[model samples]
Target: MRHFLTALLVMILTAHIAIAQSQPVLNLELANKIADAAQEKATSENWNVVITILDQGGNLILLKKMDGTQIGSIEVAQLKAKTAFEFKRPTKVFEDMIKGGAVHLNTMPITAVEGGLPIFKDEHIIGAIGISGVTSVQDGIIAEAALKAVSLN
Candidate 1:
């Protein structure tokens, strides 16, 4: 009877753990809203920047380039967003790591740029946003504002 009770308890715990975790998905409406928020922030700051939004799987959801933004920034922005989504962390984390002598991280398919941020809902990452064409810190600021618009940090 004791062994049966212990096994039953373990099974119950396993089921609870599985039910407690779920992956959130990024939909088109949310992606557009996030991009729009980022663009608005950049405009308010008088910054011509490019914004890219990606789903948690690293698929591009939306891309926006403000007037006068550098053409090269479009690709950079996408790559940054992809890196953030796939790695499940802000691009700044990787940037700081590289700056702190983790130079080997450069060999991976990730960007050590500061403009990318992951978007989370219910403590789960649903997507990411990346901004470019300004100072790295400023770009991050714009992305962060976008994440805030969606109530994600």
Candidate 2:
């Protein structure tokens, strides 16, 4: 019985290690890298925008507003990031649903708009990015470019 208990303990520890190893982590450095890429894209297009990054746990990691960007975009950007992180999908999904007559979603606590995207690493979401201060389509484009620049998918 002693030997069996020891084996079980070892198995539990091994499983814990594997689980930890498989989980993805996001930190400030990574968030800055992604925000930089997004800013670059916006600058190249002469579009001032606000960028927001949130960790998987819905914690704000970074927030940036390009020069001349509308101040209102700050909240919009954060809302977009929070919505994406909470839903585990692009905010565009909700936008599309709303356009398809899912108006009920408006009553929910979600920003059903474009410009929010989940940051994926190894098929797992580590964080999310949101852009505002430009057209919805343009914001989405910037977010996509940033993710591609960092090869985060």
Candidate 3:
């Protein structure tokens, strides 16, 4: 019985070590940098917008909205980032899924719209950032700028 307990502990410890090494750490400073880059991109076009940055688990890390931007944009950007985090894809993908008659869009607490994108580094999802108060294409562009600013391919 002692041997059996020892074996179980070894297996559990091995699994724990593997998981810890496999996981990526997405910190607040990185999230903030992405949000700031996106905000700069959007504002550079004379477009005031709201930006929301979320960690891997879809929790808000940072949120900002330029003055004169619509209040509704704040919630919109948060939802967009959350949607991307949950879906593990760009927010436009949800829009496509909805167009394909994906009923889950209505069922799930998600927005099948634009303005959100996954931040992948070293083939792992680090976080996501979203922008609102602009056109869908512009939103994507701003996100692209942020990704570039972070040098995250």
Candidate 4:
């Protein structure tokens, strides 16, 4: 019985490791492309926004702050990106949930803002993008534009 239990545990651990290893990792090149796309969108709209790109594990891949953007947006943008990646959904979803009376959601260590979105490719979340220093809706628009660009790649 002891040997059987050990073998079962090994098999379970091996399968978990295999699945994690099979997931694609976000590279600097892709992060740059996403940031550039968001930058271009924000510039075209005359919006000075801070853009943050984060990997699937919620690590910062790249960050860019447009001129005239507020300094506070830097941290806000990073937090937004982290929230999106960690939660595997757009930050707006959390915000909406809280507004609907799920107030306990605020206790979590995440920024439930509309500016953050997960970047998906082939139905898998490859990374995330967050934009700030604009209205929450406008920030979401910029992140969505970046996501679209990433999808086309």
Candidate lDDT (C-alpha), each? 0.87, 0.92, 0.83, 0.89
Give RMSD (Å) of candidate 2 vs. truth.
4.2
lDDT for 28 (candidate 2): 92
Candidate order, lDDT descending: 2, 4, 1, 3
Rank candidates by TM-score, best first. Answer: 2, 4, 1, 3
Error of 3 at 20 (Å): 5.9
TM-score of each: 0.82, 0.86, 0.79, 0.82
Q: Residue 7 in candidate 1 has what lDDT?
A: 100
The model with the greatest TM-score is 2
Residue 8 displacement (Å), model 2: 18
Backbone clash count, each prediction separately: 0, 0, 0, 0
Compared with the true structure, model 1 gives a TM-score of 0.82
Clashing residue pairs for model 3: none
Residue pairs in candidate 2 whose N, alpha carbon or C atoms collide under 3 angstroms: none
Candidate 2 lDDT, tens digit per residue, 63-89?
989989999999999999888988889
Error of 4 at 12 (Å): 24
The deviation in Å at residue 81 for candidate 3 is 0.4
Error of 4 at 148 (Å): 0.6
Error of 3 at 47 (Å): 0.6
State the lDDT of candidate 4 residue by residue for 40-110, as single tens digits.
99989999999998886778979888999999999999999888988889999999999999999889998
Please identify model 4 stretches exceeding 4 Å from their true place: 1-21
Q: Pick out the ten consecutive residues of candidate 2 with the lowest summed lDDT.
A: 144-153
User: Alpha carbon lDDT of residue 109, candidate 2?
Assistant: 96
